[model samples]
Target chain A: MVCRVILPRQFRAPELFPQVQREFGRLERIPNHVQFDFSQLQFARPSGVVFLSNLTRYLRRNGCRVTYCGLDPSRDPIAYMDDSLFFEQHCGRRLLDSSQPRPTTRPLMEIRHTEVHGWIGFQLIPWLSASSGVPETELAEFRTCMSELFNNIQDHTEYDVGSVFAQWYPQEHKLEIVVADFGSGIPRTVRTVEAIDSDANAILRSFDEGFSAKSRPTNRGAGLHYLRQNVLDNLGGNLRVHSGSGVVRFEKNGNSHQVKLCEGSGFCPGTMVELEIRTDRIEFDEVNDGSFEW
Target chain B: MVVVVKDLVSSCDTNYDGMVVHKHVLSALHGTDSVVVDFSGIPNVTSSFVNCAFVALLQDFDFAQIRSRLHLQNVNRQIGNLVRDRMKKEAATVA
Candidate 1:
């Protein structure tokens, strides 16, 4: 039997998790062929692109005959994916037809880190700062936050490969970033080091300031905390993490921060982090009074 | 002796890159009583960068020695905070 899945019109993070879980559940029940219809997709963020890539890969690996259909070249729903090289790396082909003249410029970036040092420096920081109009110094905090996310995938997950898709919308004055990994999810990896009651708790524990799953000199466990601080506390951005059978969302609406946790009906094979930063809200001049002499 | 952070690493983002700079600092620390870590011209830094570059020093040296010997110069307030926070966390972890 063939299973058909219709893609969402606007696919971005925080909103994308429940839909992904629903679609994933539908795809799981099917025994054979699967068709992912993308005609309805109008706007897609980096998280959406990564999710599509990961989902496609997951389905294909599970012995299903997967076909992508209903993609409209005119609407350009796949622009972010195309710009990020999601189609090229994941599907071994380009998304845009050769005959179609490609748009000269787009704000999306796709980072696939094969090794550590070369990718993170000049190429990433300028793009993020320039697009967001945030000062390089303030953006540095975000750079550190993202770097830690990349490090987590490399150091903790069995799969060394990680993908990051980021896009800045000048009109909206917002930057959205998605970092993903196809490996053991957070719960499974954390369980390796300490006992965890559930995937949700494992995710919650990860946010605790100095919690790292690894032991001794190597495990600093400051990545997630820094991420939370920079995104939610510093930039007033929204953060969502989906892994295994749980999803956690941290959103800052004005002065109050709202956090929500839910158990997914379906399992995400790995971990995905989606963050949205409102560029206008970032404080470049903000400084901490606390100092470290040691 | 001064080890300009920008000269050591192109960008201060990841821990691995920080570790590379940390190695350089460790080597620099051996010969001199004090070493200056200048963040001049460096655009940005992360907690992981701070943790790997400076906070990890706690593994080998005492906090007081590191405090006395290592001088952070030209760093912005954010980088300063990140370094300090990572140091405190690392101190708590080690203790």
Candidate 2:
């Protein structure tokens, strides 16, 4: 038996994710052969490509013979993925001849949690510093955010590995980052802490400050709370988390946040965290060094 | 005893590394009146690392004992606050 799932025309994430879950989430028992058709994919964001890469990984790990077809490297969308090194990293095949990542984007990558601190220091921070107004020292603050997500993947997920992609949109003055993994969803991990009604509620409640992202039963800023406080609240940007059959989108309002929910939208395996950070609000935050008081 | 954190060459991000640091520091605490942990070079750290390495000590030692014995040197406000917040939260959760 074989299953063919054609890729979407507009490959954009936080939106493309639910549609994918609806298509592939139910098929835990995948057919022996699975063909991912990228013929219609016209445009793709860095975050969206991370989802696609993780989807392919999950399918293959489930004992399915996965293959991709209907790709034209000459086209912009397929070429973009090639330039980002998505195919080479995900499929061991290059779609284009160039080996460099695109201008404002980092290449799609899979990294283990243990190596994330160094990766952020050596790879991610330098790239962001080169492309933005934020200096490397100040931008290093974002390393805590990455560390939080990586720690969650290490503690909660079946695999300690995570798929990451990032891009800076200079025109929009914003940064979009996607960190994803194929593991048990956030709702399952939350269930271990508190009793919740829906998966969306589970994720929403998990955002409470002082609550650890995983099992420590400690209130730490290194988990979802830091993501909310640092990005959505301070920068007045947006954060989207999709886990299981539910999705929650939080956008910064004047002082608070606007929460949008899409519950019961088919089960999505694992969790994906998307952050749209406002670069204008970005400044060096690690500047205060005077007092260690209190 | 003085511990220079930069010399550890540790990742200081994941729980596994956190546990390693915890064990090392705990061993350093034995038979010593106090241990000074220096963070001159390392600029930032994750809560996960602080939790495993410092907050976990609350399990074995009281806060005052930790305060008297575990003195950190040359840490930024962010690191101080993280240790404080994790300690308060863990104590609250335990209570």
Which candidate number would show the highest DockQ if scored against the true structure? 1
Highest-lDDT candidate: 2
Prediction 1 TM-score vs. true: 0.82
DockQ of every model listed?
0.43, 0.37
Q: List the candidate 2 regions with Cα displacement exceeding 4 Å.
A: A14-22, A210-222, A285-287, B23-35, B64-70, B91-95
| Candidate 2 CAPRI assessment class | acceptable
Candidate 2 lDDT tens digits, A1-294 = 667878778886655665666666555556788787889998888767888888788778888788888888888888888888888877787975665687798778888876777888888878877787776656534667777767765566888788888998998878888888878888888888788889998888878776555465543534667666767755547888888888888887788788988887656678888878766776555566634533
For candidate 1, the docking band is acceptable
**Candidate with best TM-score:** 2
Output the lDDT of residue A220, model 1.
66
Which residue window of length 10 is worst by lDDT in model 1 chain A?
A: A99-108
Residue ranges of candidate 1 with Cα displaced over 4 Å: A1-3, A8-32, A39-45, A61-64, A75-110, A115-120, A215-217, A253-257, A286-294, B27-30, B92-95
Q: How many backbone clashes does candidate 1 have?
A: 0
